[model samples]
Target: MWSRIRRAGRVTALVLPCSLLALAASQSAQAALGSAPLTPPSDASVSSRVVQPASGTTQSVMRSESSAASSTSSTSASYTVRETTFGNGTVVREYLTTSGAVFGISWHGPQMPDLNDLLGSYFPQYVAGVKAVRAARGNARGPVSVDDSGLVVRSGGHMGAFSGVAWLPSELPAGVSGSDIQ
Candidate 1:
C-alpha cells in the first residue's frame, strides 16, 4: 500500500507539469490583449472564450460621445462600445478608441468573466499583482485592484454578483478618463 501511494505521487508530480505546460501553450495561442479586436468575430467565439454556458443571448451596440479636452470638438468613432450578454445575464462590454484599440473592458454577472481571455497578454501581469496583493493582505476579502503603470484592473463581487473593469491607462484617448470606463 505504501509503495502504491509512492507511485501515485510520482505520477502526479510528472503529470502536473505537463498539464501546466499544455495550458500555457494553449493560452499563448490566443490573441494578444492590446492587439486583438475587442470583440470576437461571432457569438460562438465569444461564448467559448469569454463565458461558459453562454447562450449568446443578447448583443447590442451604442455610440459613446467624448469631447476632446482641448476643444469642444467630439468624435463618435472614439467612443464605440459593443455589449454582449451571456446566458446567465452577464454582460461584457468592450470599449474601443478611435484607432480601434480596445482600451477598456467591463463585465457584470453571476460569474466572473474569464480573465485569461479578457485580458489576453496582460493577464500574466495582472495575475502577478493579484498574488502580491493577496499575500500582503493575508487573503482579505473585498474588491481586487491592480494599478500597474499602464494597466488598471478592479474586480470584486460575492456569489451571484460579480463585476469587473479593466483598462489600459496609457491607451485611453486624450479626452477620455479612467472613470469613463464604467
Candidate 2:
C-alpha cells in the first residue's frame, strides 16, 4: 500500500509541471505568429515624426502668421446676447453670432417658473427629444448638427417653440423650410 501511494504522488507532480509547460509553450507560439503580441508606438517618437518642421526659421514664421490670423478672425466673430420682452411677460435672450448664426436662446419670466433651472443642466434627454420631434415630422435623414452647451439648448436645425421664433439655420438643404422640423 505504501509503495502504491508513493507512485501516485510522483505521477501527480509530473502531470502538473507538464500542464504548466504546455500552456507557456502555446502562448509563446501564438505571440511568435503575430496573433497576440502587439504594442502602440511611443508617444514621444510619434509626435516628433508628425509635427517636426523642415527648418526652425520656417516654423517660427508659420507660428507667427497663424497667431495673427486667429486673433483677427476671433475679433470679427464675437457674439453678444440680445434680449427682447414679449407682451406675455416672457423675456427671450438670443445670442447672435457675428457670422450670422443664432448660437443660443434663453427664455425667462412668469411663463416659465423653472426658466433658470436648466441653466447648467447637461440633459442628454434633450437630444432624444429633438430627434423624436424630427422623426415624427419624417425629416430625420440628411445633414443635421446637434449642440448641447450644458447650460443652454442649442441645435443646428429648426427646433420649434415660440411663434415666429423658429431656430432657423443660415444654410439648410433646398426645399426645407424653417417650419419643417425633424
Candidate 3:
C-alpha cells in the first residue's frame, strides 16, 4: 500500500507541471494591459452593432445569475473602452488612451477574468505584490489590493461574484481619471 501511494505521488508530481504548462500555452489570444488592445478572445461573443454614443450596449447570455444582459460602454473625448463579455458572464473592459494604448482593465462577474493575460508584462509585479500583502496580513480574507509604484489594483468579492480594476497611473490619458476606467 505504501509503495502504491509513493507511485501515485510521483505520477502527480510529473503530471502537474505538464498540466500547468498546457494551461499556460492554451490561453486564447487576449489583449495585454499597457499595450494596444487586441481583438477579444475568440470565446467571447463580441458586440455586433454599435448603439448611440456613450451608450453602446450588447446582449450576452450569462450563467449563474450573472449575465451582462446589456453591456453598456461610454467614450469620452480623451479615452475609450473596448468591452468584452465572456461566456461565464464576466465582462472585461480595456480602457484605452487616445493614442490607443491600453492603460487600464476592469472586470466584474461570477468568475474572475485572467489577470495574468490582462496584466501582460505586469503580471510578475502583481504576483510579487500579492504575495507581500498576504505575508504581511497573515492570510486574511476579503478584498485584495496591490498598489505598486505605477500599477493600482483593487479586487474584492465573495464566491460566485467578483470584481476588480487595475490601471497604470502614468499611462492614463490627459483629462482621464482613474474613476473613468470602470
- Winner by TM-score: 3
Q: For model 3, where is the 10-residue window of minimal lDDT?
A: 63-72
Q: Please give the TM-score that candidate 2 achieves against the real structure.
A: 0.25
TM-score-better candidate, 1 vs 2: 1
Q: lDDT, candidate 2, residue 16?
A: 36
Which stretches in model 2 have alpha-carbon errors above 4 Å? 1-77, 112-127, 130-182
Whichever of 1 and 2 has more lDDT, that candidate is: 1
Clashes in model 1: which pairs? none
What is the Å distance of residue 59 in model 1 from its true position?
16
Where model 3 places Cα greater than 4 Å from the true spot, the runs are 1-29, 47-76
Q: Which ten residues in a row have the lowest lDDT in candidate 1?
A: 44-53
State TM-scores per candidate. Answer: 0.63, 0.25, 0.67
Q: Which is the winner by lDDT between candidate 2 and candidate 3?
A: 3
- What lDDT does each candidate get? 0.61, 0.31, 0.67
Q: Write the per-residue lDDT of candidate 3 for residues 109-172, one digit (tens) a residue.
A: 8877678888899989898888888889997766889998789898888788999999999987
How well does candidate 2 match the true structure, expressed as C-alpha RMSD? Answer: 24.7
For model 2, the run of ten residues with the poorest summed lDDT: 44-53
Give candidate 1 misplaced runs (Cα > 4 Å). 1-32, 38-76
